[model samples]
Target: MAITQPEEDIEPTGTKTKWQRFKSKYFRMKMLIWWTLLGVALGIILGAALYSVHPSSVVITLIGYPGELLIRALQELVLPLMVFALMSGVFNLRHSGSGTGRIIRWSLLYYLLSMILAVILGIALVFIIRPGRSRPFAANNFANCNSNVTATGATRADKSAVDSLLNIGRDIIPTNIVAAAAAPNFLGVITFAIVFAAGLITFGQRAEPLIQILEMCNEVFMKIIYAVIACTPIGVASLLASTILKSCSIISLLKALALYVATVLGGFLIHSFVLLPLTLIVLSQNNPIKVIRSFLPAIFVGVGTSSSAATMPVTMKCGEDYGCVPSIVRFVVPMGTNVNRDGAALYEAVSVIFIVQAHGLTLSVGNVIVVALTATLAAIGSASIPNSALVSMITVLQALSLQEYIPDVAVLYSVDWLLGMIRTATNIWGDACACVVVDTWARRHAKKNGTLPIKNPEPPAEQEMAMGVDSSKKDEVI
Candidate 1:
């Protein structure tokens, strides 16, 4: 060996080997995985133990309240950031002057069609899963815990179709902008932001300063978002443990828990694995699996954090890495985070129906349709943050008077964190799908204009060179 060492066998003494590097990297990832697993395990254990010892303890309240507060704080950051980011993105694309019209048309079409598909799929799944029919959950317990019915009010007041439609229209446009911003209606904020950004963009040179300022504000808000996200695991653990301990019973958990879990998981599977991909394939003419693989990390983070807004940066980064056009990713992902709530829609519809059936409420076809539509629209109006579901649910129940039959809002208390996680996952998936659809459209336009390379094009010069073929010979062969 000393006489003649093979060139491939040579090694440097000061540098670490590939195996060593891999080990270091692997250990770091492993530690993170183990830490997360430990957190979840502890949460489950504490939750179960607390339920057994005392169903309603002050300790639970202390932990639960702060966790809830933290979630609200995170939510408060989402609406403005989303609006600014999305509008900025859209304005940038418009200014680029490259197929802006086509991009806008395709994006709008894809968004609307995909949402309709998701709604239909959600309704179908809710009916098929029938998680609510497993057992007749005690009406009083459910009413006491989950009801939106007030003590003095009747729960069964029927509203006409005309009234419901009018109420929806009124709620969409807020009377006071300040009040809306203070409460943080994402849709309202988005409406304001889009008009603001559009106006700023129209001013050209005069708007330059304003655009710069808005961009700076967006950056600052993102920093705040990051700080908030850093605290998520602890907040989630506390929230989950406290909720489980306070509201869930071992008997109920054993009986209806599986049904709840199945319905959620099943709905997610159908949306993520089936409906979303098909939409991408059909509309964008792209490979859905590729989009999914690219978005996996963001999806995981969204599920863990239970927030699409919190996951926005990661989602945008992932979209760019996966070859999504910046214009499309920036516009569609942020907007989808706010409005494209496929998962929330699915979960809300299923949960409402489940609760109703569990309580042995005889729901007519009209009731089911109303619940589905209400859930979908309510989810759209919901702020893109954590723990906003209860508020949104309150609005929906009030509108429909479903709360009259169920008097207490406490039933949702036990599973808020779990449902939040599921909803967040769903929201993230919808955003990813939106990116795919937008990217497909952008790429196709780019290709048509000869900006992007053609798919399955002829071999590059290097490959031809390696094959010992001259340009002239290659042309002749072709």
Candidate 2:
């Protein structure tokens, strides 16, 4: 016989070496992280050097254009992703062992509990830290920025807390679904999705083909987001740099706002890294670190993007990949992106407290409690978009009739983009945790009802040990 090599002996055609594969697959992503860090470093350095430059200068504007485009792209993806992803979620719940109604109940319960806890934590932290009020430099140094911010907020803040709360509910019930869809009101769009999904589930088996179409649409949107996300390093660098260039003076900005920044970020770190992870441990009865590791990809993406609406696809994928039930993954994640805003709730409460304190006012125990409650409600009404918290912070400020204090919101606004990323990442993590909780409940519920279809892995090995199969027999079978 000819000396011919076996197929296994031959190297696979078109297969790249390990180094080349790593270069192709991970080079851009690794670069993205390093560049973002570099951007922040460079931003602060260049900002200090260029403090004399005006924000509207051609160079700053051009550098900012990429970041602006990224925001616009996120806006474009928001509506369709919410509608179709939620539709897919409902579709899966209806088909999976856990039916749609049960998943909805699980989703809402987790969402509400998360929001309430987050709001309370946020208010309590700000109260204890006393960031803005303790700092004298910030109030005295940024007179122009503060004045401009005050003028913008005063006009819209005439309503009381009660009035704002009442109006917040009304915004959820949009006048026309079409207008909501086009204007891309996340709350309205989410409501429309639920009703439409309920109608489809009413069709039962007939909805299968339509659900497949939606599944495909969801995948397409996810791919698009991934592609757009690759551009984030440049976009983030541009955005942060632009923010720096717009500053009146770096030393003044830092001295004035350092305490407020620390308070907000410290609270987020405590909540996200400590309290929230501990809650996950209690709920899932699993290693919280392992659970968090499963979702790191999505978390990083959310941090980069700073919008839950934009981060939905990655959030959904993370849940599924973590082995959550399909129904829970679909329903819980989409709904969570819209409603499970633990971090946003926390941020808004802190922002309100920081602003109130910075303006040389104080809230009593009763008023502090009320602000916490109002902040939780406002977060529910707010879109899962960047700077929407600023929009709703007006309601909280107006309710207190400290509309004059609104100007200091500008200090908070100075670092909103970077702060938005941290909070948004925390928000996505909450949503992922909710998925795990819902999945755990659904699995238990299904098992109780004897409908759970548990997939058996390493069944052969397990049975081998249990049945005492001989090694020879095992080898023969193999």
Candidate 3:
């Protein structure tokens, strides 16, 4: 919690002081979440109004630059943010205690399992929805079919999933770290960061300086990102205006977008509500709804901002308040936000399949598997940016030789505002959900195995929260 200074004790600085005080009071997870939603609602209305007016290119350019700038700013931060934050966590391995190892191991195991499952779910949903199919059959959502079924039934093995898998593996652990950095291979970059950070653990306090610097660098990136993100409403309004004018106004585009929008949002709904909550319940044996409600403030912040990195503070804070051990909440949410974007991974997977289907291409088991792998990579590559998944989706499309279909899939951005919010919120929710599950699983095992010292039992959860419980708080059981 932020400390409050007395009104009389503080010196006034005109508009700056009022702004500072306003930020101090309301610039928190709870309030920011509401502000962001307002931005969305207001932007939508403004966008529609502006489009109706047929604004000139000069007007459009001026209005749209803030939104474009926010994205560009985030793009610049993604690489360094991932590198510093993940490396910083790995460097703290030994000092964070024995639990840190399992936290990393099990958290990662769960992250991959959830992501794989999410992608599979997305793939299955896309198969059913067939968003990228020919407009006549797809517009009413398979109500009348067959014209677009030509490319739906066959699976291609020409590219071979095995070869693609091997190629990705080789790229993950590159021969030259510098070369990987220069080329900006996110997988290899993260791999190198993990290796170097682990090596640094051996130096003990000697590594402290570098770790502190990394932490500072991470903070710097965060501040910059958040500052840029505050302009989201302006950007959203401009993008909405442009999108409505260019994309939604076309009848062909509208028909093409119906199923695709439904598919992306449907995938987000299932992943956010069914898949993740169930995983959290099965692993931690906690009430998934209550867990989500406890962190709803933070999740909504992610929804509003559409950036997980920007939602980190709220997530970490909410996780701790929800009874996650402070250490687990602190480390897990930060690192997980950086890497475990389950929703984005699922979106990427669905987008790739959607594009291929739209292009009337033959389907293959190998192609499906390749998409799954590439989607996961893309999720990691563009983890930190909102509405930025398409950038990495291009990478996946190109890998499968589907790059030429990019223009065909451009309709996605028209509805990306809401789609981005839902997906971003889901991504942040998954991190907090994983934190609770991991904390529960780790502490339960630690207690049984004598690694964790036993303490007083926690009060009833409702009673504790009602009483503002602090002293008797303990990690929940699985």
User: Each candidate's TM vs. the true structure?
Assistant: 0.58, 0.57, 0.64
Comparing 2 with 3 on lDDT, the higher-scoring candidate is: 3
Query: Taking the tens digit of each residue's C-alpha lDDT, what string does model 1 give over 1-478?
Result: 3686653343346644434543443353334334434445666676776666664356766766646765566446655555556564445533433335555566556656655666666667656766655443432332255544333322223445566555444545778767766654433545666677777777777777877677677667756765664554565567657645644354564456567657767777777788888787777777887778888898887766666765776787788798765545655665676667887777666666665655545455455555666666566655565545544554334434454322222334345556677667777877887777767766676678777522211223432222222222222210
Ranking by lDDT: 3, 2, 1
C-alpha RMSD by candidate, in order: 10.7, 10.1, 8.9
Per-structure clash totals for the candidates: 7, 2, 5
RMSD of 1: 10.7
TM-score of 3: 0.64
lDDT digits (tens) for residues 1-478 of candidate 2: 7887753333336654333443433444344345445545655565556656454467777866776776556556645654666675555446333234566676778888888888878887787877765333223223344433343334434435565566445546789988866554445556677678879877877886887788688768756756665665555566656655655555544654677778778878888888777777887675778888999988987777667765666676787788885534655676677567888789888888776655445555545655776566556555555555655565556544454454344345557767778888889989988888778877777788887533211113322222222112222210
Q: State each model's CA lDDT, in order.
A: 0.58, 0.62, 0.65
lDDT of 3 by residue, 1-478 (tens): 9998864344434423333432443344334345455555665576667656666667766665666655455556666766776675554444444324556777778888888888999999999988755632132112232344332233333446677567667767888878766665556776777788888878888887877787678768756655655665565555544444533234544565688778888888888889888898788898998898999998877776677776676787798788877656655676687678888899888877876665455456656776887688667656365555755565566556553344333345546666778888888988987898888887888788986632212323332222223222235322
Q: For candidate 2, what's the RMSD? A: 10.1
**Model 3: which ten-residue window has the lowest total lDDT?**
136-145
Of candidates 2 and 1, the better by TM-score = 1
TM-score of 1: 0.58
